[model samples]
Target: MVRVIMGVKGTGKTKQMIDLINSAVHSEHGNVVCIERGGKLTYDIHSKIRLVESSNYDMGTFEFMKGFISGLYAGNYDITHVFIDSLTKIVNADVTDHTLEEFLDWLNSFSEKNNIKFTVTISADRELASEGVQKYF
Candidate 1:
């Protein structure tokens, strides 16, 4: 399952994502593998769920996807759910506005074959990027 929680800035998208994740882990007793884009996951929550933090380390789109896909393929069998916070931040560093389509295609394929539940967040202003992403998925 893939879900995108989108809205304008200051709309509490990150908080909403965190709440949803927390609910799944704490209330429902679900195993959650959370991928946090910013430091929000570390500083904002208190839980025993597995958390992976990836911030702006100058990684490009391909490099980011490579690490993400490889990690997921290798470790997915151990977890039941995956939450990817703010998908836009993964590509924000480059902001290439190029290779968006290709990246989206790869993401769609990877998500499907892995059969992992994913939560993706994005900015409301990134229409092209978001549209390309939704189309591919």
Candidate 2:
């Protein structure tokens, strides 16, 4: 399943995502991963969950970010949940409704295929989000 935590910047989205990740770590059986734009939150997240800082790599496009996620799934078959703190920032794009829909469609399919749940934080108002993406919020 794909879920979104939508809100503007400095609205405590990261804290919410961290809380979800920590909860999953204790409640879920499989592995959990958290991907962020930087390493600032590394120490804040539970040590059990894998925290990845994408700023260390060149993930400047949606395709690149998708490939990076695919790589994670390939490397670890046990990953059950993935929490992305800054989806737009990681993709380095001004995601419009069209782009958001396309990305969500692909992500939904990928989540189903891999049997992994994805919870992402998108910096936008609930009404501004695409209908497809808003359903996950």
Candidate 3:
């Protein structure tokens, strides 16, 4: 399953994701992974959930992010839920709209094949976002 929390800045998207991640830690049988663009979430997230800082890897583009995520799954097959704190922040500022759409489409398919659930927080208004980006939300 793929869930998206879409809204503008300061709308509590991160808080919502934190709550979901913290709550899932108690009941999920498999591992829970949280990916953030920076170290901001180090304290709010539960200690049990595996937190990854995207800056540690070459994920400036969504294409690279796909490989990074695939490698994570390859290394740890037990990961069930992957929470991306801010999808927009991980990508390079100059990327094309097509890149975002392609990555999201691939993510949805990848989750289906691996039985992993992905919850992403996108900091953009649903209406103002591109048709490609809006579809994911």
The prediction achieving the highest TM-score against the true structure is 2
TM-score of each: 0.70, 0.93, 0.91
* Candidate 1 lDDT, 21-127, residue by residue in tens: 77777654346777776566786555677777765445446657657656765865655567766665765632235565455456556667766556666655544
Better of 2 and 3 by lDDT: 2
Candidate 3, residue 132: Cα displacement in angstroms equals 4.0
Give lDDT tens digits, candidate 3, residues 1-137. Answer: 77778888899998899899999899788999999988988999889999999888857877788888899999999999999977878886422367677777899999999999999988777666666666666
Whole-model lDDT, model 2: 0.85
Cand. 3 TM to true fold: 0.91
Which runs of model 2 end up more than 4 angstroms from their true locations?
Answer: none
In terms of lDDT, the best-performing candidate is 2
Residue 106: error of model 1 in Å? 2.7
Q: Write the per-residue lDDT of candidate 2 for residues 9-123, one digit (tens) a residue.
A: 7889888887888899888789999888878778888899988888788777888878999999999999999988888888875546477778878999999998999999988
> Where does candidate 3 stray beyond 4 Å?
93-96
